[model samples]
Target chain A: MIVTVTPNAALDVTYTVDSLVPDAVHRARDVRRRAGGKGVNVARVLHALGADVRAVVTAGGATGAEFAADLGAAGLPADLVPIDGETRRTTTVLSAVDGSVTLLNEPGPELSAAEWALLAERVRRREPEVLVCSGSLPPGAPPDGYARLLAGRTSVLDTSGAALLPGLAGRPAVVKPNLEELREVTGLDDPIAAAAELRKAGAGAVVVSLGADGLLAVTAAGTWHATPSKVLTGNSTGAGDAVVAALALGLCRREPWPEILRRAVALSGAAVLGPLAGDVDLAHYHRELAAVRVRPEGES
Target chain B: MIVTVTPNAALDVTYTVDSLVPDAVHRARDVRRRAGGKGVNVARVLHALGADVRAVVTAGGATGAEFAADLGAAGLPADLVPIDGETRRTTTVLSAVDGSVTLLNEPGPELSAAEWALLAERVRRREPEVLVCSGSLPPGAPPDGYARLLAGRTSVLDTSGAALLPGLAGRPAVVKPNLEELREVTGLDDPIAAAAELRKAGAGAVVVSLGADGLLAVTAAGTWHATPSKVLTGNSTGAGDAVVAALALGLCRREPWPEILRRAVALSGAAVLGPLAGDVDLAHYHRELAAVRVRPEGES
Candidate 1:
């Protein structure tokens, strides 16, 4: 069973409008909510891929109920810790014409130490085969909470900044950082150099996603690069989560690292073809996987 | 005593964010909910102005509970009819810097005939001093339902479209339409011409709320133009509703037409400061009343 922990979970809402006019009244045509956090996103994707997963997070008030509804609707089993403050909500406004998305993010309710302890207890109760920690650390939480959550085992850590810095000390099985985050973490202009620096900072292996450009890796299997195959994009909301799921699967199944990168790229491409988040077609994934290019070091 | 009826009330939720992104994840920084609908706004403003006011509406489920809580918090009495469906929610997204608002309106649950019957029964029992009907006709309801709910010599009908057409035929004491809607109803671009046409159509009197411009009225006394002292602008979510509340109050007290529009403009100006619909500052309203200007015109 895969266990994903979202320390700062949110009820995500999306609004569809013709155009956003600042300081003007706009009538939104649509509103949608989903339980979100990096860990929750990873668990949902893995579950869609036929993996047994448990989504754990803390919540409160009506916003909390919304989070549960979102998870239940997505077919993910969830265990949530209750709190006094209402759970936070995230709003996204999508353009009705081209589907361009804008995001407004909230810092979220501050969690008490008791709540953190409660979440840790919930985690201990449901021992997951593979543990995934996602999103930022909520304020008041110790920086090393992610490392402690994994208990030094081979875990998949998908995060950046404060959590990423301290979380890297635990040396998770593999760390997945997007290209920008990799640069932010390592202060390097080059993606390859960033991945190497992150690996040096105690991340056992690093898979830095480069979006449309593809994937880069640095691990025991050696440095390698895989470019994504051409696939029509529909929505990219959960494609990154899909890549994380594919990478975790590859490590757990002990598949070859290069093949894992190939699969990750294909799965993400497949994800972009689906309408809503966490939706991917395995049929498309397999078809795209064969066309991926894996270039070894010094290939050029 | 002024009583306002909202057949389809809502828990208005406003989300404050930096920007909106579609299909992508965004977080909301602030969340606020209030009892909403045109009638509710009227009653809220009347209550703020020290008038004896009662708000009669239907509320249900958890959102309904929230609606009642907000009404209680605001120091207003709720003669709310309960329904099986939860009270509908209206979401508005506002940008903090720009003060721009976006509205996502939900067509509330269909009001069963039983619910409609219940609201009518409540009105009969109360027989308010000045009954004010506001807001759009919900689905599964006839526009003339407002006329069916209240029948008296002094009732005020402030509605549009179907509600306006049928309720006007019922010969309510007063009807308030903005200039644009007046054109749609009477096919007259001229205010005086439109007022005569509505009177011919059976309305006893008509008041045209011209927003920042001011109020135009054709009453039993004479034709009068009430112009506001200044445009103190901010958020104008419920300025019209505030004007309606003051109108109902004036008719109830039998205030001289001049004092009526003066107080109306003052109250309407105060409403411009509130973020939600129908909110007004009593102090602001009182301060501006002394400066309100009314000019009598040639009319019936």
Candidate 2:
């Protein structure tokens, strides 16, 4: 079973408006709420692909209750650690006229030392074949939170900034960071150089997601770049999580690095075709998988 | 004793950000939540002024619980009618850069016919000396909901559009509409003619709020206009609610038309000087009260 840990879970609220005019009042035409976070999205993708997965999340207050209810309604299994502070919410306003999206993210609640320990204990109790740690560390949480959780476990780490560097200490099997995150953490503009830096820092393998450009991986076996034949257009919100899900599955199956990279690229492209994050069109995935081209760094 | 009814109450949330840019992600610097609705604001203002006031509102779901907790924390008296639908939320975004404000309002939960009946029953049981109905009616609620509640009760009515015209059938002691609402409901640009139209429709008196210009009142005693001596520069969000609060108090105390109009204008100006709705700078209110000018309509 794969276990996903979300340190800062959120209740994602989406508001659809006719148009968004700055400094004006808008009446939302529709409102939707769901349980969302990096790890939650990753676990959701894995589950949707028929993988055995469980999510471990910290929750508190009313928003937390709603998040838990949504997760259950979605039939996703999770272990929830109770906290005193309320869980934060992320608001996305979609403008129907211009199709513009505006996001407002609330910095999640601070976790006390005791709360952090409780969360770690919960994840430890749910021993799994693979552990995936994703998302930002909440205020008051130790920066090395993922490092501590990844200790002695086969894990995939996905995060950015301060949380990103400390997590590398965990020596995760795979560390996935988008281009922006890669540059911010490594201070390198070149994706190849940034991935190399993370691998040297302690990552067993560093996977970099290049948005529509596809996935680049620096592994002990070799460096490889994978891309789809044609770019797919859709919402890219959960594309990275899809990549993470594919990588986790590949690790479990002990697939070769090239095969893993190809699957990751195909799955991510499929995710882009879906309206919401953590969802993918299976038909699109299969079609893209055949079109995905994976080659060693020097082969191109 | 005054009873204020909010058919569609909301949990008002304010997010302060460095700046508001369209279609961009924002991390809120600060967040604030409060129980709010027009009637709730009126009740809060009256309570702050040491008046005997109670608010009647419908609430449900997690947001409702928070709203109730806020009201309790404020030490305000209230009657909460439970419903199956969740209370709505209104989000206000404040940009620190240019001090611009953006508002997003969620349509409140739809109340069932039974729920509306229950709300009316609760208000009837209270038998308030002055009944104050404010804000929009929720979906599934009668457009003439205020009319039914105002029947045979000394009251002040404040609403717009369909809700406004039907409410006049109840013959509320006073009907207050701002310039925009007067035009929208009566289809006349002239406030005097529009106010007259409403009075003819069964309203005992029509009081029109003219923003910085103060208030215009047409009553059986006489036609009068009241204005604050000078414009107070500040947030005007709750100024109308302040006017309603003063009107309720004036009715309870049996103040004359001109005296009531003077107090309404002064309180509204003071509310503008405060940061939030339902709050007035007491010092400013006192100072403005003395400077408020009230004169018969025909007099210069």
Candidate 3:
């Protein structure tokens, strides 16, 4: 089964408020709770795409129970490793009037050495077809700890920070970062130049996601750039996760570069229009995929 | 003893983030959990004011446990009536960058008939000198619910909506509402006119809080207005509760009308700068109270 690992996951809560005022009382109009984290986000999108995937995550306390309850409510495949402190609760406040979103993320419960070891052992036991480690490292976790688990697997590293740099030391199937993150990672502003730097720096392949513009991929075969059919406007909360989800599925199916890039762009575009983060409009995504265009980086 | 009846108390969780981007992930710099609800706030603030107060409220499940835990951590007196569903949690996302606050309020767990009876019985048994029924009315509770229980005692009503209307109909010793809420209750924009309407409508006495402008009290003796020595700039999350807290304490001591109003305004002004809603800066409040001035409404 397709597997995803989220070292730290959370109970995601979204609130709708009439207005937000500084240090004042506000009456919330509505609220929705779900399970969230980068890797968990990727797995959710994959599940939405009708892909059978197993999610491996760490949680603790009543908040962990909240995560499990939310995941169970969604019918997602979960292999949650219980720990000590309560799992964190991440809040998203959606101001519908102005379409402004505020995120209040809790640093998830800290993981002990024993819990981390148990997680790694659990991953070792499940020979997942494709292992995607996405998002930030939780507190108490070593930066490259996620990458070390990719030793015998075809892992996709899609996180930023000291973690991403160290993870790149061990070449993974692909590492997807946006233009800004690419600039931060390789100190190159131009997409082509940045992709080149990543390839040279040891990444097996580099897929640089450019919001609104689309995605660019560089590999041994060559380079390709793909753009969505239309610039759809909506929340872009989980667009990157959608791209990662499609990229992993495409890798598993051995889809050609052009098809993979086109599909990923459409999926991300659909995700931008979804109300929930990491959720894509399947019909719209499928319809838009056929219209996505991929041009060979217009170079040799 | 000061008795606070929080029929609809809550567990307040505050998450502070750098910026709030709706439906996106945010990293909270601080997370503070505390016991909340109007009555609970009154209990806490009153306790801080040297009044021995017992928080008599209902609770259930983990949410209730956490609510009780917060009270325990603060070293406040409490008598939590156990029930079925988990207590509700009120989440506030405070943006660290701008200090903007957003609230996500949950409809608290429904209390069974047995639970309601138990609460009423508890109030009947204690009969503290001054009783405060503040905040929202819990679900499954009738509108006149609290008023019926605190029947003969000198009760102060600090609430709005159906609960406030019914409590007023029962002739509570004192009722306090901000100018706007007083308007909502009396359908008049004028504070004095609104307070007069309430006094005529079965309310024993009416205290209409006008922020910055000050506090106006209408009683059998006469109507008087008390203004703080200085208007300080700060949040007013629990300013009204602080007023009620000061009132509860002053009334228990049988302080004169304008003196009660003076003390209430000073405490409320100090509360504007306090961390927790309804909390007052003890030193500031005391110092400011000494200089608080009360003016006759007209030949009082």
Q: Measured against the native two-chain assembly using Cα atoms, what DockQ does each of the candidate structures obtain, in the order listed?
A: 0.37, 0.70, 0.49
lDDT: worst 10-residue window of model 2 chain A = A229-238
lDDT, candidate 3, B140-237, per-residue tens: 98778866865777879898867777787667789998877898877888777888888887778898888888888988888898888888765466
| Candidate 1 chain A, run of 10 with poorest lDDT | A20-29
Task: Report, in order, each candidate's fnat.
Answer: 0.61, 0.82, 0.67
Question: Can you give the lDDT of residue B67 in candidate 1?
Answer: 90
lDDT by residue for model 1 (A183-233), tens: 887889887787778778888888888878778888877988888777465
Which predicted model would earn the best DockQ?
Answer: 2
Instruction: Find the number of clashing residue pairs for candidate 3.
Output: 7
The numbered model that scores best in TM-score is 3
- Name the Cα RMSD for model 1: 3.9
Residues B28-118, model 2: lDDT tens digits? 9898889998899999899989999999999999999999999999999999999899999988887878776788889899999999999
What are the per-model numbers of colliding residue pairs?
A: 14, 0, 7
Model 3 alpha-carbon drift over 4 Å, by segment: A19-24, A179-189, A218-222, A231-235, A272-275, A297-300, B19-25, B95-102, B233-235, B297-300
